[model samples]
Target: MTIADLHTLTGAYAVGALPEREAADFRGHLTRCAACAQEVREFRETAARLALAVAEVPPAALRVRVMAALPEVRQLPPVPAGARGRVVSLRDRRWRHRLPYLAAAACLVAAAVATGVAVEARRDADTQRDRGVVAEQRARVVSALAAAPDAAFHTGALTGGGSATVVSSTRLGAAAILYRDLPPLPGSRVYELWYSRDDVMVPAGLVDTKDPSGSLLLQGHPNGAVGVGVTVEPHGGSDTPSGSPLVVVPL
Candidate 1:
């Protein structure tokens, strides 16, 4: 294929639809063309996600039915040694005409599976990298708040069990909460933090109920909030406190 033709093959290449020679040419081009490479990457990711969104599980009896019918299916008989120029049946001719298309379809299916696996792997790596960056930034904020000259600490006992410690730095305009020996909640429930200001509470962040003992840097600056409160909420958390605070530590 010409160079211009190779440039248009990104979509086909991403889906493994290119012939072997053309695909090889495009692969070489991709190494030197950053834009084409990026487009191909995006195309693959979109295709993979679309495939996953429409995928379904087959019925459990499907394999059994297929196996049962296999025994009754006829197989093509082999030709005699001297029958090279013999007339071919219409059925044989039809099968010959369809052979290439069937092979191509199989190749496409295999390519799609391979693309999905690659996309999932890349997504997982990106997620891990993002988590690491977030964790590092949180640690820095927590440390800075703890070291501030105006930092004040308050500890309160939770209503049902355990305790919560709040470290507030008015000068830094932030606070952090550390939960200790907190009891695990139901799978559908979670611990959410809030900042109380003028008797109005604003959501801070959600705590992982599975790890009862953990710490979180509240979502926003304290902004003269009176205290920090923890409460039980649905798994994704609530816009406002759904129930009374489990623990409230005055700032």
Candidate 2:
């Protein structure tokens, strides 16, 4: 999808209204686009306040009246792709993507005010905003791991099969890694990352090795870590190491 199309869905994404595929795509976009992430965060915060401001109950008769009116209403046909731009307001420079957002905003306002959906909507916005922050931070860490002046990298062979490589920057306080040619783990477990300090291992983050190879962002003290290790842990990861290292590299 175009960036503009993704932009139009920012509100929908903030409120969990996008279709599953589009929502997944937008979330992937969120990891790499700080501007979009920040926009989603702001929109979510505003949506939450709107939710809290609209706590009144609608009159009982209103639903009955709306249901009564539906049969007489005529539906408009879908606009053709070529003719869709005919409604543009030539006066506005930002008209390109505003229509969808305006429509989404109007729907949000109506839903929040009329349905009294404040609690659910506010909770979702808060959760989505927090996720945006985490995704954006991971993106920053990955970028720093690649671009920072103090960046360092180490590579080693994995147990059973394959090879692992870690790249990190002490100045940036983050690390990232890529792996190749590894066997997948069992359904009950996945790979998790850890760092070393003071002769002890600290849980740095986790990654899926289900594909047997992929990349992941590992934030927090990658720069200062004395070593890096990967282990097999339960899906949510263990607070402490739960298995012997599949790959270990002393930095």
TM-score of every prediction relative to native: 0.50, 0.44
Residue 28 lDDT in candidate 2: 89
State the weakest 10-residue window (summed lDDT) of model 2: 49-58
| TM-score, cand. 2 vs. native | 0.44
Task: Name the best candidate (by lDDT).
Answer: 1
- What ranges in model 1 sit over 4 Å off? 1-125
What value of lDDT does candidate 2 attain over all alpha carbons?
0.66
Runs of candidate 2 exceeding 4 Å displacement: 1-141
For each candidate, the alpha-carbon lDDT, in order, equals 0.74, 0.66
Highest-scoring model, TM-score: 1
Per-residue lDDT of model 2, residues 1-251, tens digit only:
88867765665576566779989999988998888788678656543432332223435554565565445434335757997566666655486468678767766666655454445445656766775666556544454344444555577887888777776666666677666667777787877788877767788787755556556666566555678888889989988898788878777
lDDT for model 1, on a 0 to 1 scale?
0.74
Per-residue lDDT tens digits for candidate 1, residues 1-251, read 67776676665677676779888888999999999899778656543432332233434454554455444434346767987888889998998799779767766765665565557556665766676666666655665565454566678999999888787777888888877778888769988999998999999999877666656778998977999999999989999999999988999
